[model samples]
Every structure is written in structure tokens, then in C-alpha cells.
Target chain A: MIDQPARARDFGQSRPHAGENPPFLLTTSSPGRSQRRLAVCVLVVLVGALVVTAPFARIPLENTEALLPAYAAAVFVNEVITASLLLALFSVQRSRAVFALSIGYLFSGVMVIPWALTFPGVFESLGLPDAGLQSTAAIATLRRLGFPIFVLAYALLEDSGSSARVSHGSARSVILAGVAGVVAIACGSTWLIVTSDDALPGFMKDTRNVAAPWQYVPATAVCLYLVGLCVLWIRPRSVLNLWLMVVLCTLLIEIVILSYLSAGLRLSLGWWAGRLYGLLSASLVLLVLLSEKTTLYARLVRSVSAERRAREARLTAMEALSASIAHEVNQPLASMVTNADAGLRWLGRQSPNVDEARAALKRIVDDGHRAAKVIEGITTMFKKGAQERVSVNMNRLIEETLRRCRDEARLGRISVQAELDADLPPVMGSPVQLQQVISNLVANAIDAMTAVAGRKRVICIRSARRNSDAILVSVEDSGTGLDPKYRDRIFEPFFTTRSDGMGMGLMFCQSVIEAHGGRLWVTDNEPHGAIFHFTLPSADDPPSTAGATVR
Target chain B: MVMSDDSLIAVVDDDESAREAVAGLVRSLGFLAAEFGSAADFLASDQRSRTACLIADVRMPGVTGPELYSHLMASGTPIPTVLITAYAREAARDRALKSGIRCYLAKPLDPDELLACIRSAIGDGKGRIE
Candidate 1:
């Protein structure tokens, strides 16, 4: 049926390498040049900030007692949101590395509340369990130590190739276990620190300065962060790895400023800047993930709309093709009906005209045969697979198509000239399909020249050996050239410039050529008009009688 | 105005088989039938003046059935035309009727209807031959 073309809709799955394939941007995709450059730019900016702030690191500012609680609140919000987003990604990807990092963020975010409550002055009204000064410092050391350790774990597991081994049902359980473990560890560490404050070392000196030994904790964290950075750099880098390196740079800068450069002062300029870097580190991956997901969403919408347009085009082509089929088949059926009536009328006469009746019956039989031929042609057009292939001489095929189109050319005032290479090899394909392709091209050429006046309308068809193994055929028209913008779109189904055109002609030609393992394209003819060219692979061995003379 | 047994009825169609079939049917009814491949062919022949009635395929390559009919009427040599179309649409039939076409018939045409249409086209009730 003519409607079968619509049912066999090509959803753009065939041409994977034709510049229309969707881009992969998640952790699975390696970082491209632009992402690498952007990461480098961020590194330069962060390092530049550190260099500028180093000289003023020792200057002490007045402590706003409210600042610690507020900073902790902001960090809590940033880390929790970042953790939730990562977890959401983990659920989709089922990646162990992402799960570890998300749990690390969750641990840090949850620990901040208790750390701030025990800090001393601002949250004293809450009567929180405060173990003098060491309480806050202990929680800070745990969070700093836990975060980099998780990063180290992430770097180790990222390329383990076990990400997809976790089934969907197990992914939920794993996520739950990770969240519960982080919460339990946070609570236990907080309970152990506040209860055993007497056994803890004094890392803070009179609430304004940190003792020298306290720097060892951040220094140890720095070492872990550096190791994680080395592991990530050694592994194949994805967009996630690229941004994580930037986040790690910020972490390195923050630790250096807070521990080494601030001269042990709690509210110094380096300390304040270090806190801001902490917030920046938490937000970087979150921001990148959000933007990448947005781009992925946009690409999805575009592809879906493109598929919808292709579907609609196939439907329209089907409708147009069936209408033409109806018109064609009805012609013979009408003739047959009239002939049968005439046959009966002749037989029914008072003086029966037997000879005339016999002629009418013969015409009816001929009409029936014509109708059957019409149906056979239609069926051959659609039955693309399992068709018998034979060695076909290209020049012979071209001559036959031109002969068939003779009346059309004469009516349209178009002169068709054939330029054949007499020594061309035979190509392997269904002869009927190849003939249809040539006929369609010739018809289109005539249609293109229908509007021309002053200039001569000439269609030049050429057949030659393209290479040792391929035969190339070109149909050129000396009419108005095709629009440059419509070069690719013209081959798309149901895309037509002609008002009365069904728009299936070029699409049919392209599909046929492609099915025969050939390529079809158009180029501008010299001075004026367009030339359509197609190439077919020559058969392995031509049959003994396959060579047909070229005219 | 009764149509005689020898009244020439012209059948024009692009399809040779359909043209011949219609001409065969007309001849069996005792009318003299002339078959043409197109309206242009019919017009080029002397049958244009002698044709008592015209049966033309509605759609053709160069000039359509309705267009040829209008051209003849405009030239002051009006011939009653019955249009047959495989690609029938209601709007086209209505427009052809409004333009003074004698009859519009769809493909796989009912022969009885065609005979009556031809009878009415040449001269209504008195046009039928004994």
C-alpha cells in the first residue's frame, strides 16, 4: 500500500554520523576543549585571588560574634543542596563514586549545625552542649578530614567500571545506607567530642587565635586533597572531573589561607576570604550540573520536535501517493467497466453482433491486464527487501528512462541529451527500482525547466565509471538552479518548492540510491540550473550477456 | 433535434485503452464514434465541427477537459461536453457544473448513467435513437 512508507518512518536513527547525533555531556562524556579552557580560566582567577590576599593575611579584624553561626548556616544550606543534587544524579547513573561524594557533602552539611551551636558566644541562648573551645574545633577537623577522604574514595572508584553493576532496586538501598551512615557518624563524632572535651587538646588560644598544632589538621586535609587531585588527573577526565579539579583548587586555596597564611587569627582577612572560598567550592559542581542538565533538556526537545516533523511528512507523502494510485488504478477499472457493458450490449442486440462483442470482451481483458500491471508497479516500488538483483548496464538503463520520458520532454519543450561512456561496467541492483530513480530525476528536471522562457531548456544525462568499482550517473538541467538553502532540505521527505508537487519524488530517488549502496547529491550546473548525481557500486562479475550497447 | 444513428460522438482521453473502451461502448449503441488521444488531437481533426457530442477525460497534460470546453464555447462553436475523471472531487464537479458542463462522471463509470447523460446532452428526451 502507498501508506506503507509512513509506517516505515525513519526516526533519524540511520544517519548516526551525519552531524545530527545528540551530544553526551554527563560524567560519561570526556571533557571537550571549551570545558578544559573554562577550567583553566577559573584556576587562574582563584590563584590570582590567593596571591593578592597573601600579604594582608595576618591583619586581625574585630570579631562579630554573629558571624560564625551565620557562616555555618550558609555552608549548611550550600552543602545540603549540592548533596541532594548529586544524590539525584547518583540515582539515575547508579555510580558508586557519585554516591560517596554526595554522602560526604551530606555529612559535612549535617555536622555544621552542631559545630556552630558549640562555637561559644552567638548561640549561647540555645543552651547547646558546648565543650568550651575544643568542641567546634573537633567538629571542624572531622568535617575537613571526612570531605577530602570521600573525594579520595571518589577518585579511586570513578573508573572502577562497576557503576552500572548496581541494579536499580539496589541503588535505592545503597543510597539509604549511605545517608544513614553519614548521619550516624556525624552524631557519634559530635557526641564523643562534646562528652570527652576534657581529653581533647586545646587547639584555640583565648578564642581569638588558633594554637600552632591546630594547623596540622588542615595540613593533613591538604595532603588528602592533593592525592585526590593527582588521582583525578591521572584518570581519563570527564566534564565532572574537570570542574572537580577547579573545586579542588578552591579547597587548596581555602585551607592554605585559613591555616598557614592567617597567622593563627580567627577573624583575619584570610580567614574571611577562606570562608567565601568554602562556599564557592560547594556551589561550583552544583552550578555546572544545573547548566549541563539544561543544555541536555534543550537538545532533547529539539530532537523530539524534529522526529515529529519527519512523522508528519511521511503521513503527508503517504496521502499524496495513495491519491495518485487511486487516480491511476481507477482509470483502467473505469475502462474495463465500460467495455464489459459494451460487450453485453452487443450480445443483447436483436441481431446479435458477435464480432463486435468479441472485440469488446478482448478490450475488457486487456484493461484488466493493464490494471494488474499498475498494481504490480506499485508493489515493486514498496517491496524494498528480498528483491532479485541482476547486473544492469548503467547506460542502457539511462536510455530506457529517457525513452519513457520522451512524450513529457516533447510536451514541455525540453530537449534531453545523453552523454554516455560506452565502456562502463554493469552495476548490481533491482533494475525496476533503478529505472524509477532515473525517471523521477528526468521528470523533476522537466518540471524545473517549465518556467524558463528565453534560454533553451536542455537536460543532459551523463553516465561514466566514477572509479574502478563504481558507476556515476548525472542528470543536469539548464533551468533555474536550486536554492542553496534548500540543498539538504530538498532531499527531506515532503519538502517541495513546487506548488503542485507531492514532494515525494526526490526522497524516493534518495532512498532508492541509498538502498543500492549508492550516494545521491546535487550540485550547481555551470552558468545556470542544478545537476543531480548518483553513484552505484559496480557488480563483482558482469554476466556474459550483460553488456548492452549505449546509444 | 433527435440524434441519428450516424451522429458522431467524440471520445478524448490521454489513456488509449480508456479512450478506445468509451468509443467501443458508444459504437455498440449505434452512434458513430471517433477516438482521440487528447483535446488537441480532436480539435486538430475535422471532427471538431462534425462532433454531435464530446466525452473528455477531465484531467490531461496540456489542456484540461473543462478548459477545452470553455475554449470551444468562447470560440462560438459550442459542443455539449460530458467530463469523466478518475480523480474526482466534489468541488471540481460543482465548478464544472456551474461552468455549463453537460455532465461530470467519476471513474468506473456506470454505463446506464453515461447513456442517459449522453441522451440529455445532445437533445434531452428527443435525443435518444430508436
Candidate 2:
């Protein structure tokens, strides 16, 4: 038993917390150079692989004279350039594992280069008798060295952000499994290599002509099958995992063709598996490259979206500042205007108006006191507003919002109205935030009415019961109908249709409502303008979250 | 500002053009007007004790309309206020009407309708006739 959420853990602790997110928001303009260089390096690897596999299509291992030189040359070139790229990356940043891998890669890249360069003739220079040089030991050395090239490539990938942390497996377990699988595959490959060269296994056959390299076809097929099973066990969803399995299956089928070549003492052509094997390997490498590119593209897209959201919040704050200021300043200003008007009237009247003049003076004095009081109220509110969250009444919230805009509505000749939902329950929320939302809806309605030339300029605001679940308030304006296409996106920040409006209004409204555990939306009222409505969730729900504590 | 019947309303505002305009609009419909220059004099006057509908300007220099409304509201004067402000704030309006404002009007207040709202909030001026 794994004693863990075995299947769930397979997705790991979300994504691996690694340097996968670069240290800084890097805007490196030089990516063009690096990307092109990487692309060229990839092209070189594929070309070298092709050139190396080509000549080997002609001869069996026993006929080494025909193929070794070119194979060595191709391997050497591919390894060297790959090593250079890794080394360049290492020099740019000392990201631990990459540096270590580069050390090994650079060494291997150099050794393979000389080996591929001196190809076919290098086998002749082995200084052993020709037949002895074709011994299984000779072939086994090449197999061991050739296999590590792929292992090294996997190392490079791990260094590039594909940390195994995302897979929930212990590092020790993965390493052990990889090692065991590689050893098993290597042993099977060794059998296929030795048998295909037609060297008889003393225990399996008597008087057998093992000179036929193609005779081991069934054994080679079995070896390829093992490689497929191991890759599938390691990573089911990885493209590399799927491609490696498919390639091995293809190689297994080609092994059947080897049977005929071996039987004809066409030991001269029995090395056919080598050419087929090289092609399948190269194709898998290409698939891995493509999958990596796609993963990079997805991660880039995710970061871009996060950046956009942060930008939008700041924009919304800027757009709603005016309404916020009005809500604060409107109260006292209205009071002063009323007191002044009353006082001014008493100044000119007849009937000696003695009592009336005195009364007006008293109101004037009262207006001054009220104005000072409102200013004090606003000063306290702004200074402490940023300090903490407080519970606010939805009913008073509506009134204050309307009063804030009282002057504006008066100036526009449009009527402002309100009907408080008598039974509305209190909701805990940010007052400023809720104010911003209601103001946006009201302002938009006022703007819409500006274009109309009719006397039906009533803005009916009604607050009503919304069943037992919510408190609903709707602002019904008598402006023209809104465009249908603009419906869903009206709440998208900075995406406004108005030339003078900061597109942030609707979006900010939606955000504020959402923050308060409520919903805000707009609709066309029957026969006329827009009806914007919002609902704040009741504060009576029993806490389902772990952190809730009743006061 | 509103007064229970027999008590006259003095709606003093500065925009004489707007004040008399509003006065004519209100008086033609029926309401009293005792105008003055600033709050300084209104504090020094006699009507402070017995006056009725106080339709004052919110932006007056010495004392604002809301300042007068709050003072009266705080004193438990039993007078209903029909505050008219050009403010677009929810908090302030809510505070003004928490007890029960006849109506919180935004100016330029509709002269005829505001009087009607004031009359309705306190009971038609005739209610005091009983």
C-alpha cells in the first residue's frame, strides 16, 4: 500500500514549486537569438541522426567494413553540438542540475564527434583479428555507449522544469525503476545484437549456423516489447511516453523482416534491424521536442492572463473615484443649500416678517453646524476606511448612494427615486465597494437618458423582497434599450462603448457584488431603458468553512 | 424643510433667480417663504423656535441645509425634513433619512412636488387643522 492518496497524489502537490516561474518578470528581447539558435541545434541533431543511420542500412555487423565510419561521424556531430547548447545555457545561469548535466554532455559531445569522424576504418584499426573484432563483446560496448545518449537527453529535459515533483513519486523510487528498466532492456538488446550476428548460443542450438544475423528476429521483437512496457509504466500521459511505446512496437514488427535476411547467409544484410531501429529512435526524439514546445506555450498563456487581471483591478479603482467622492461630499452641501435658500428668502419679505426672518437666521446657523458635522464624518470615514472591514446596512447603502448623486441628477433634470425594501436583512460587506457598484449602475442609466427628448424621465428605484434567500434592489431607468451584443461583455473591465466613460464601471460593479457574495446584472425594462439589479446574499447561513467563528 | 400647519415655511435660497423662481413655483402651489442672506442671521432670529417648512439651500456659506436639518433632527423638534442636496452619496442620504425624512430631495428641487412630499410626510397641512 502506498499509504497515500495514491491516484490523487499522481497529480502531485499541484505543480512542482520550482524555479519554473523565473526569478523576475524577464522581458528578454534577445529571445529571438536564443530561439533561432535552439532551432538550428535541433535541426543539426536530426540531420546527423539521418546521416549516421543511412550507410548501416547496407551491412550486417559482421561486415563492419561497410558502415562504422559514417555511423561514428554522425553520432559525433550530434553529440558535440547538443553539448555546446547545454554548456551555453549553463554559462548563462548556474541552475544546479543543468550545470551537472552540461558537464557530462560536453564530455560526451566531444568523444562522440571523433568516433563518428573516423567511422568505418576505426573498426579495422581495432588491432584484433577481423572475426574477433566482430565478437559480441565488441558490439556490446557500442550498445552501452549508444544507450546513454538517450538517457542524457532525458536528463536535459528534467533540468528544463519537468521536475518529477509533479508526479508524486519519490526520487529514489523513480531512479531505481529507471535503472532496472534500462538494465532489463539492455540485456534483451544484447541478446538481439549477439543473436542477429548469427553467433549460435551453445545452450540453445546444436550444429546451428549462427552466421545468419537475421535468425534472432523473434528475440529482437521481444526486446523491443520490453522497452515499450517500461516507458508506459513511467509516464502515461507524457507524449514522450506514448511515442516511445509506439516506436518500439514498430521496431518489433520490423524485427520479423530480419528472419529472412539471416536465413540466406545474407549475414551480409542481417544488420537490417540497426537501420530500422535508428529511424524509430529519431522519430521519438522529434515527438519529445514537440511536446516540450507545447507545454511551454501553455505556461506562457497562463501567466499572461494573471497579469491582465491585476491590471484590471487598478483600472476599476481609478474609474469609480468620482462617485466615491460625491457620496462623501453630497450630504453637507445639500444641507447648506437648503439653509441658505431659507435665509435668503426672509431677507426681502414684507408684513415686517419679524418672526420669519429670525427663523431663517436660526436655520442658517443650523446649516453651518450641519455642514461642519458632515465634513467631520467624511474625514473620519476616509482615514479609517482602509483599516478594516465593517458590516453595512443595504437599505441605508442605497439612500447614501442616491444622495451622493442627488446634485448630478438635479442638474440633469432627471428624477432620482428610491423605495427601501422594508424587510431587508443586514449584510456584512464593504460600504465603499457596494456604493461604487450602485453608483455605476445609476450613472450609466443617467447617461442613457441624456439622449432621449421625452418627459418620461422617471428613474424608478424599487427595493423588494427576493424570497427568503436574498435582498434585491433594482434601478429602473427610462433610457433606450442597450445593444444585445454588449450584454455579456458589459462587465468586462475597460471594455466600454462610451467615448467619455471609463469602461471600468460595469466591471467594477460586478466585482464589488461578487466580493459581497452577491450578483449584479442588467436587463432591458419592458418598453424602455435598462433595469440594473443586484442581490446581496443573506448573512444567516451557517458556516460551512473551517475558519468561521461566531461572535 | 417642513412645518406642521399654521407654522409658516421659509425657503430661503441664494439663486434669487432660482429662489424666487422656486418661491413662485411653491407659493403658486401654496407654501410660506421667509428668506435671509446667511445662517448667521437665522441663528439670531425668532422663527428658529416656531417656524414650519424650512426649504433652505444646501450650499449656503455660514450654515448648510443639512446642518440645519441635523440640528433640528437632533433636538427632537418633531419637524420632518425634506432635505434637498445635489450630493450623490448613499451613506449621507441614509443618515439623513434614518429616522424618517419626508423625502431627501436633490436640487434643483421640484418646487411643487417637494411641497407635496413635505405635506405628505407630516400629514397634509390640514392635519394640524384638527
Candidate 3:
């Protein structure tokens, strides 16, 4: 059994976005060319700005120590904000990319404070014991390298389908355990480096003191990572992958500025520019992820309102259906009651007329059965289950439909004509549904002619073999023709010209025809009116047979 | 009540059972009855002149009961008419009354009510003749 309420709630919670865009906002596959162009344009602008500002950036500052707290605060704020946003995204849709990204942010945030404190000038200025330049370089290297590696891992794991294997409950627990483990590692590593600065290699210490020779190692590593990221960026599999490429690109620019162009002293223009770029790179993925979450929430609200409107339409349809049933059943019942009463009057005579009474009694039985048959047709039509299809004679079905609407046609002063081809093959479809289609068409034709003055109120219905595999049916009316603009929209649900019309009649007819593997449409009638046409495939033909040749 | 042999009661209805049943009820009340499948058929017959009290269905093929009554009044032969309907619409009843119909009854009509209506129409015919 399907859990309808739960499914509805899920729609309310995680509704899919409408229109051409997918719920994963940035995962568009076809926009790679444009995105590449945008990347080039941004790269050009950044390079030009750097070249123009290099002369002014060469001047050294009076005190680099004054800027250390501000730089540390900016890094801390960016990393923490990014981490929280990634965590929120992972909670919404548990994925390997989101989990790795969140942990990476947490690591960067935790390591940045220690990196700031252990920097040579900042540490001595704060009057704390100096954890030498080597320790600070190691921590800075780890923090810078952590994000790109995690991002690359996320991009490579796009099609791994790791998220599908984990259940919702297990995924939540895994994320929590991963978060705790990262915190422990970050704190433990920071403490080890701060307490015993000698654990670092002598070469790392020598490189930190000179800063020129050993910088090439990290610079070369960043360039190689940039090349790898560019290759992956060419054909990003998801939104996260694309944004990750942008983050990595910005990180490469920051690394080039800090390790290649900047002087050993603090507060250089290259240093400030590199830090600003790093802050931007850290926030890009989180911004994209958070925006996607907001779009998903907006989609949820739209879907809930759409469902509520659908429910209201269904209730209105039910009311209309009941009214139709009452109208149909009342005629036969009236005859039954009158026949029974007439039968009694005949039998109560002084000289009892037995033969006449028998005739009246027989009519009562017939009328009762007729009413029962009407009820049976209604119940079968509305029955909620798989519909049964069988070979049906189009001519007989049309005749029956006309018979049902004969009284209304006559009362409306409408002359109905039928031209059914005798040699036409039977079509495969549900009899009741097809009957309703014809009945509705005929009724509409009569309604359309109700207001016509000084014109022949005629409704012509015809059925013929359109091809070897299909048969065509048409209902033509000599009434006011539909506007050419509304010709197509007339079949849409809740679209109607009549004030009293429920507007579901044509929509229901179209659906019934479509369900029978056919097509329904309308055209302008000759002279002045409208004609509705539909086609059904022959029973002997396969479902994939060529469509009927009818304009 | 004995209706005059010369006075014919015309029954107009589209349904075979309903038309015959109403005719049978008219005959049971001792009136000479004639049946017409449609208002057009009744209008074409010579029985229109002889009909002292006409019992017709409100809805029928070609010409409805109220329309037939209007046609008769327009032609200056206003016969006393009783309208019977299977579907009871207040608008139709009001239209029939406005057209000067003697009675408008909904089906399964009470036999006594119909009999009383026909008897009074016959009585009025006699009074008008005198």
C-alpha cells in the first residue's frame, strides 16, 4: 500500500523545481562553453588589475603585526560561515561532496587561529612564547592544501553513487562522527606543533628563514593542482563540481601571489591581495549551495499550493459529477413511478382490465431496469481501478450516445444527423469512456446552438475509416464558431466560454481519447461553426501504428 | 366520472412507456384517450378539434407542451391543457402556468390529482358550452 500522506509530506518538504531548470541549481550540463568564456574574462580582468597595482604594492608597511588579528578574523569568519552552510546542505541531501566540503571548512577554520598566533612577529608582539616560523609555515601549508584536496576528492566522487548506499539515519550519524574526528585531529595537530616546534625537519626551518628557494615546491604543487582542476572543470558533472573548480582557480591565484610575488616581510600588497582572494574562494561554494537550498524551499511552497488547488478542483468535479448523475437517473425513475401508479389504477377498476394492467406492469419493470442500467454505467465509468478495454463498434456507440441525448436535442430545437460508415473496423477502447466522449460532444453541440437565431440548428456526427489502422470521428455544429485563438486552449481544464459550464467536459473527452491511444482536436466548421474530431486505432493494429491522416 | 364520448383526451410524450401509461390512466378514469408520440404528431391529427382536455408531457420532440399550447392560443383554439413532466423544473412549471395551462403535475403524478384536474376541466367545458 502506498502511504499517500507521507508522500504528500515529502512533496511538501523536498518538492522538485518546475520548468527547465533542475533542483540542483548550478548543475546545468550544456552551459560549459559560456562558463569557460566567463572564467577567461574574469582571469583577464584579475591579471590586468594585478599588473596595474604592482608598482604601488611594492611599498612596505610600517607595522605588519597590526594587520595579523584582522587577517586571522577574516579567515576565521569565512571558514566558519562556509562550514555551517555546507553542514546545512549536507543535512538536506546527504552526499559525499557536501560531507567532504564541510569537514574541509571546519579544518581550515580550526587551523587558521594557530597559524596566526605562531607567525614570528605576531606571536612576539602578543608577548607569547614564539613557536618559530617553521611551525607557522607547516600549519599554513596544511590549511591551504586541505581545501583543494578535499574539493578534488568531491569532484572525482561525483558518479561514485556513495550517497545512495547510505540510509538517511546512518548518513546523519556518519556526518556527526566525521565532524568530531576532524575537530579532534585539528586540535591535536595544532597542539603538537605549538608545544614542540622541533618536530619539524631542519630543512623546513632553513627554508622558512630564507623563504625564496623552498617556496617553489608549494608554487609548483599549486600550478599542477590548477592544471588538474582545469581539466576537471572542462566537463563538471554536477553543480558542486563547477563551484569547486572556481574555488580552486581562486586558490591558485592566491598561492601564486603569496609564494611567488610577495616579499618575505609582512603587510605587502601581494600578501593582502592573496588573503582577499583566499577569503573569496572559501565563500564561493557555500554561497552557491545556500542559494540552491533557498530555491528548493521556494519550490516546496509552490508545490504545496499547487496540490491544494488540485484538491479544490477535484472537489468541484465531484459536485458536478453528482449533479450529472442525478439528472441522468431522474428521467427513467420518473417513468417507473408513473408506470407503476398507472398499473395500479388499471387493476383497481370495477371491471378489472387485466391485459392493460399487465402492459403497464411490464413497462414498470422495463423502466426499473433502464434506471438500474444507467446507474451501472455511471458506477463503471467512475470506478477507481484499471480500466478494461475491448473492441467497440463506433457506429453502435454513436447511436447509443445520440439516443441518450435525443430529448435534450429535441428540446433545444437542434436537428442531429449521423453519417456512420458501415465498413469501418472496430476500435479498441473502454466502451463507457468512449460513450462519455461522444455524449459530451453531442451535448456541447446542442448547448452551442442554443443561442443561434435565424439559423438551422444542426449537429452532424460522422465516423469513418481514416486509414487501414485507424478510424476517425467528428462532431460538427452549425452554431457560433469558437475564436481562433481559443481553439487550442478550449481543451485545457477549467477553460470555458459558457458561464454555467464546469469546463471539464472537453478536457475529460481529450483525456479519454488520449488514453485509448488516439488524438483529439478541434477545427473551424465550414460556413460558421466548430467541428471536433478524434481518432481511435483499429483493434487489429499494433499501438505504434502510424497516426491517422486527418487535419 | 363519465367523460363524454365525443370529448377526446390527447396524450403527448416521447417515451413509449410514459405515453401509454398516461393514456391508460386517462382511460381508467372513463375518458376517450388518444396517444401521440410527439407534439408535431398531435398537431397534425384531426383529434385536436375533439380534445376537450389535453394531457401532454412538458418536454417532447419537435414541439414542447408549452409551445403547442402557445401555438393553439395563437391559432385562436385555446383548449384546456394539463402539463405533466418527468423532470420537475420550477421554471418550466411557471412557464406552463403563465401560458394558461389548467394544471402542471410532476410524474409519478398522483392519480387522484390528475383525475380531479381532468374532472374540473370537463366540468368547465360543460359550463362554457351552456
lDDT of 1 by residue, A489-514 (tens): 99986789986666888988987787
Best model number under lDDT: 1
Provide candidate 1's TM-score on chain A: 0.63
State the lDDT of candidate 2 residue by residue for B16-85, as single tens digits: 4345444443543446556655556655668755455566666676677677767666767645556655
lDDT of 3 by residue, A381-482 (tens): 754353777789998898777766654664465667677777889987779889999999988888889999888888878878887888999999999989
Kindly list the per-residue Cα lDDT of model 3 for residues B24-93, writing each as its tens digit: 7787676789999988898899888888888888888779888888998999988889999867889878
Best by TM-score: 1
TM-score of each: 0.70, 0.33, 0.61
The segments of candidate 3 whose C-alpha lies over 4 angstroms from its true place after superposition are: A1-44, A47-58, A61-85, A113-136, A162-164, A201-217, A220-224, A227-231, A234-236, A263-265, A290-326, A372-551, B6-46, B49-130
Question: Could you give the DockQ of candidate 3?
Answer: 0.35
Could you list the CA RMSD of all candidates, in the order they appear? Answer: 17.5, 22.6, 18.1
If ranked by lDDT, best first, what sequence of candidates would result?
1, 3, 2
DockQ of each: 0.59, 0.04, 0.35
Model 1 CAPRI quality: medium
The TM-score obtained by model 2 is 0.33
Off by over 4 Å in 2: A1-221, A230-235, A250-273, A291-299, A302-551, B1-130
